[model samples]
Target chain A: MAKVPVQFTLNGSEKAEFIESGTTLLHALRDKIGDTSPKGGCHQGTCGACSVIIDGELRLSCLTLAETCSGADIKTTAGLAEGGVLHPLQRAFLDAFATQCGFCTPGMIMAAKVLLDRTPNPSREDVVEALSGNICRCTGYEPIVQAVLTAARANSQNAA
Target chain B: MELRRDYFADVRKDGLHEIGQPRPRLDSPGHVTGKTAYFADRNFPGMLHLKMVRSPHHHARIRSIDTSEAEKHPGVVRVLTAKDVPHNVYTILILIQIGPEDETVLADGKVRWKGEAVVAVLAETERAAQEAAAKVKVDYEVLPAVFDMEEALKPGAPLVNEYHGQNYYLYDSGECRKVRFGDVEAGFAKADHILEQSYQSSPIEHAPTETTGCVVAPEGNDRFTCYTNTQAMFFTLDNTSIILQMPGNKLHFVGGTVGGGFGGKVDVIVEPIAILGAKLTGRPVSFIYSREEEMQISSPRAAEKVVIKDGVMKDGRIVARKVTGYTDAGAYSRHSPYGAQKGAGHYPGPYTVPNVWIDTYCVYTNRTPSSAMRGFGVTIGDFALEVQMDKLARLIGMDPLEFRFINAYRDGDMKAHRQPTEGAALIECMQEASRAANWPVAEKYMAMSSYRKGA
Candidate 1:
């Protein structure tokens, strides 16, 4: 098995690694690049625990082949925070007690980040739709939904 | 979520400072930062991936297990079968000295259910391990499998577990957990109306986002450091030590950070074998369940069938209550026996009845073994009891809540099991619930309280 070159801008920094050809972007990021924000809840694309923003598009890292993601800008939950402060969505999730078990938090934050970036002040239904791909078994989804709406409300108020 | 108006908060103690406060969780910082260390997050150098070769047949006697091909597979570290385990047979309840050793780490003689692990293949990579596991051949003689609990209990039916010597796990007193309070027959004879009903529930999977898994690393002092996602860490350590025939001091189990247990991660499923693999290879071993495995192979809450027979008066008073329940324990008795016994204690419901009889049987069937989930013993029982309450209320032309208020268990009231119930609040709780829902209750029902009973 020969390692192939994978070049990507990861979390505002350029990272180059020679990874296995058939390796998933989840494994490449977590196992190779030492960024463990993207969890491998399921190897299948069904569970969005491995969700990452690649080339400005939300993609399931487990379904996306690592070698095919060459020369792409990838963003994960680890990159959500600024220099020292927490992201508004992260703070919202933390405050809302949305991270029970914390397994689904990374993907959920990533997915919500995309939603907030695109749709500021999303409705409760929109927040629910955005996080429909991510599964949080512990929290019955109410807290997570409330967390997203809280962040959205805060963001809209700040803009106003 | 809107905070409900609590009627009892006014009389509550002064020490209750955090009742309705929205507080941050202690793990919030780590969780939001994506740094909470789960079992799978640990990346050990030279860690061997372990995958299982499962049985496709529901009931099959293993004729032979040929692991030669798997062992010879490229990058395959080792292939292990039943013979490799030091003390193969065990039960999770063995720590409490509850049931006999009824299960094996790997199928020793026969696999009682589909997806039973028969062979373990360890390799350099997960893909290689899975491929090598597929290479291992297990020649099995398919046997007749009985899937239903009642069907399995019939005469000449195929036995799911021969160790039990019966389709049902035998309690010390009889074949079932029995609770007899008074003469239900006499009460039924005097009752004005008789109501009988049946209730059954399907097995429920926990389906936690992160599946059951463990990473066992061999330390320098001949000790194994196991990082698991088990909700019960000591259960894992003790069970693993006992299974491996090693002293408990040699194992350092690090856990308690679970990815949504919901009473599902209490089983000591993966740690023992992962520890064995680490011991044999002197390298870290990771045994994780895939989504399919977590759904199918892992034990879920028991599928239960209950028949409730109640003798009721014209005034909605339940004179006699007889409950016959069956716990579909599946292939083996994991916690089903204990769960059945626990279910027995909840017989006749919370209402005080003079005559009550209960018999709950933990029956075995050729399916995945059932264990604990959220509210394992009483949840299903409560469903049947409450539904029966509603039915009895309908028959008597009475409000369900008022009917319950009349028969509600109170302080100094003797329960079905003979224990006097203290601090009973069913009456007040119902009163408050009725008020909160804006359901108009009669003056007498609204005035009822648990403390001032018969006043």
Candidate 2:
């Protein structure tokens, strides 16, 4: 099979690569663009470990084809921090000890970013519903939930 | 955040530092930033991908395997079978003298369970390896398989493991693990009532977020370095070396950042085959199980059946307890014998049952071989024993907590295995739990202590 040329904006940087016809966006990001943030967990849309933002919408990179992602804007956990300053969610996660093994952290932060962007002050239930698709076997969801709530409060206080 | 000083008023005297202090996990930043180097994170130039050709039947005799089509597949590098493995027979518990080396790195003559790997294909791409693996032709003759523990034990049942020479693993005494303390018949004869019940649990999967895998790079001539997520690094190194018949120094294991082991990664599953692939192809080889394969083929916690019979007095005292249990070890013994022995050791619960008898059988059946998980042996046994206690308490119209308080083991008491108990805190733990739950206990029951009354 001939490789198809794909061009896209990744982490606010225009990137181009040639990919196979059936290559997942996750493969294109990790193998071609050398972005290693999105992990291959289940690779079946259930784990959400390969979560990335496509045009302001949360999408599972394993389920999205690189060909379909051509010319689309993408955001990943790697893009969340700027100039070595951690994002609010990342700081909150650190303070609250939200991660254990850390395999699920990137996707979890990405999921929380989508939720916080849509609703600045989400309730605990709102956070839970947003991250329901993401699975973390380590922390049992307590600290992660608290971290999201803590980040939301900080964000709202900054806005005030 | 204010510290809850009152809750730890009693525990504060331990003079512990960092125990109560909030410390960020050393790996959290790397985890959050997606910079942690897991086994799958590393990529090598000219690395080959490995995929296994697995058996579709639960039990079958492999008459022949034709790898011609797979070898002819584009980009396919090498096809390995059991013949390629230098020392094929391996049982993880062989170090503990608990096995006859029942399992092969790849399927030998017959496959005893579904998803047993028969052929390994190395290719330039994972897709090519998977495609070539699917093309490998295998001729199998279906055989009778036993799926139930009790059915496997009956006379004339088809043998699942010929290594054991029977359906059950034998201890040094040539029977299942047994524990007998006092005369249960006499204890039962003196009892007012007897209660009997059976408890069962299905197998449990660890289901770590990251599946089992390995990446082996040929470092030097006749030397390989394996990057894996196995919980026990040296165990993998030693086991893989034994399987490849190579020196221990030839294989360097790089690991310890396990995503989540929970006892699942203790088995040397992927390293041997990945190392073999690397050796045969003379290229770095990476073998990772898809989520489907992990779910279907990885070792799971054993499904267990426990039957407890207790002779009790009217005052909630269990005089005699008899336990007959079976651990479905599946087709091979990995850690099942040791797990069953742990179950036998945990028999009769943490109580002062004067007369106790326990027989734990490590049974074999046609299922995915069970190895270990969190508290593999004691967890399931405690589940059954505690539930039996609760049922007994309900039958005698006694408060469950009070019943436990009355029967909780005390220091200086001897166990069914003739080991004297030390630091027995069952009574204290129950008291603390009851106090926290606000369940009122009578003055007499509340005064019962784990410390011996006379001492």
Candidate 3:
């Protein structure tokens, strides 16, 4: 197997690197780039555990090959906090207890963030519709929905 | 969401939330942040990948195995057959009758079902390991397989387990668990009407976002480190120890942040295979099942056919209940006996009855084995009994909710299985739900157009 040189922006920093052809983007992020934000839950795309923002779009890192991310700007859940303060969504998630087992949280939160960013103030039904794809076995999807609605409400109130 | 002064006072006085309050889960952060390290993501130095060679025939006598090509492959480090297995049998799920002494770690001399592991191959690369596994060949003397329970029980049908001398997996004497209270016949005689119905549930997958996978690394002398997505970590460690002929202290089992179990991942699916592969290579070996493999091979909800009978009076009081459950045990009676037993015990559906009888048959099937899932065999049974009650209520020209309210088990109602239900909250839940949804009105909405959509 030949080591292929691939260059990509990770989180915020620019990077130029080479990886094996078979190296999944998840492996590249965790091993090469040292970003552990994209967890490998299901190697397949079934579990959104290995989700990353590629070119401002949420994508499963496990399914994406390293070669595909050569020119793409990547964002991870670890990049959510700008400085010392928690992102409002992350804070609301913590306050609302929207997480359990925590494995699926990153993907779910990223997915939620995408939805919230697209529509700052979403309804309860909209929240459910947003996070439906990300499966949370614990809490039966109730708390997560509540947390999203809470985040949306907070965002709207802050705007006001 | 608020309640009485006493209830609301706890929030101010003790600074505590409601006990049943809808709080979000606690583990979502680690999961959402990608900080959670599920077992398959772990990396180690000199790590090798493992793959298995499985049987194609459901029932077969292993004639011979050819692994020369696979062993000679460029990246392949080791190829193992049953001859290499130190332990003959290892149980994955230990319940009544079938304990840690029953299941096979590797197919030894005979393969009982299709997809049973026959050989394991280890290579430096996962792709290489998979490629090399295809090189290994096994010859088998095919035997007629039995896919039906009734056929297996017959005198001359092909025996899946001839060594056991009977088709019965767990209980040779029949009843997994039996409970007797009042005379059911006498209790039924006092009732105004008797209702009997059979309900069947299809097999369902847990479909846990994560598929079964395990990474096993040799720690020291006969000791191994295992990281897998298993619900019952202790059970996996114990069973793996027994199968490897190693001490319990020699094995360490770590559960990854499982995506979702719903009880399916409780059974050890990828552990033994990974362990066997690691043993062959003497290197860190990781084995991950494909989604298709996970779906077909891993434990599923037991497909059940339950027959429930209830004797109710004119006033909607249930006097007697009898339930019979037939659960498809699949390839092995892993947790079927216990699951079926629990199903039988819970079937009367939280109702008050003087007499009850539940019979559960853990019948055999050639498909993947059935094990635990959410509700632990209670949910399906509950659905069956509740639907029956609704149908019976409609037949008697009474409102379903009213009928349920009339016969609802309360603080002092004796359960069908003879236990007194103390602190029964069904009525309270019903009242709250009805107040929220408006019961009679909700029923009216069910009759509304299917095209209508709203929250």
Clash count per candidate: 0, 0, 18
Local distance difference test scores for all models: 0.89, 0.89, 0.74
Candidate 2 local lDDT, B331-440, one digit each (tens)? 88988898999999889889998999999999999999999999987898999999999998998899999998878889889999999988787877777788879997
Among residues 3 or more apart in sequence or in different chains, the pairs in candidate 1 whose N, CA or C atoms overlap within 3 Å are: none
- Name model 2 segments beyond 4 Å from true: B1-13
DockQ for all models, in order? 0.80, 0.82, 0.41
Which of the predicted structures, 1 or 2, would earn the higher TM-score when compared with the native? 1
Tens digit of lDDT per residue, candidate 1, span B1-455?
Answer: 34445434554555645767777789888888888888888888899999999999999999998888889999999888888899999998889988788998999989999999899999999999999998898899999999998898899999889888999988897899999988999999999999999999999999999999998889999999999999888887888888999999999999888888888888888899899999999999999999999999989999999999999999878899999999999998888898998899988878989999999999999999999888887899999899999999999899988899889988888998889998787877788788779877789887766666463
lDDT of 3 by residue, A1-160 (tens): 7899889877688987788897899888876777777766667776676777788787888889999778889888888877756678788778877776676778778888888888898888888887776666564578788878888888899999
Query: Clashing residue pairs in candidate 2, if any?
Result: none
* Candidate with the larger lDDT of 2 and 3: 2
TM-score of 3: 0.85
Docking class of 2: high
Model 2, position A61, has a per-residue lDDT of 96
Docking class of 1: high
Score candidate 2 by lDDT.
0.89
lDDT of 3 at B366: 61
Ranking by DockQ: 2, 1, 3
